[model samples]
Target: MSKIFHPVSEQEALAELPRLRQRLTAKARHAHQYRGTEGKSLMAQAKRALRWHQLFVSINRRACQ
Candidate 1:
């Protein structure tokens, strides 16, 4: 599937920050609540997603500023 790209204005980024933060927190919590091999795999994925969201949030904050 092809993805569409668009610019996000400062206002939009600022607005999205809170929701992103919430998702980041949830991901962190999920990453911690697991055990065994399957849990390890799932936690790895969650950590990766958390890192991506963190980078996005930081970039958004910088752009907004």
Candidate 2:
């Protein structure tokens, strides 16, 4: 199945960064504590999301400056 892509504006991305970071950290801790497949899966998904947000934020920041 294909996933639909929705573009996020720089401002929105910036605002969401903090929440994404917090989620990633929480997922990481849970994964470490549980050492279970579900935790690992969730942590991986969070990492992917945060990576995307970070990349978008960095690229946009550079472009705008």
Candidate 3:
């Protein structure tokens, strides 16, 4: 089996950003709320939030180009 990677169009990427940002915000809130109380899950949520940040940068960079 193989996976295909398709870069989204600039307009599509721009449209998706707001949704991703909302997810990032939710993940950040989860991470913060569970901090200390749930170390493992908090770390996981934080990692996911970080990935969203990276994706935001990547998508924005591509859109700029």
lDDT at position 48, candidate 3: 81
Question: Which 10 successive residues of model 2 have the least lDDT summed?
Answer: 1-10
Looking at model 3, the pairs that clash are: none
Give the winner by lDDT. 2
Error of 2 at 42 (Å): 0.9
Q: Which residue pairs clash within candidate 2?
A: none
Candidate 2: stretches off by over 4 Å:
1-16, 26-36
lDDT, residue 31, model 2: 80
Winner on TM-score between 2 and 3 is 2
- Report, for every candidate in turn, its global Cα lDDT versus the true structure: 0.62, 0.71, 0.64
TM-score per model over all chains: 0.46, 0.52, 0.47
Candidate 3, residues 8-65, lDDT tens digits: the string is 5566766776887777667666665564758566667666876876676576556556
Sort every candidate by lDDT, greatest first: 2, 3, 1
For all predictions, the C-alpha RMSD in Å is: 5.4, 5.7, 5.3
Better of 2 and 3 by lDDT: 2
TM-score of 3: 0.47
lDDT of 1 by residue, 1-65 (tens): 01222345557766876786677667656765665576667657766876776566566555545
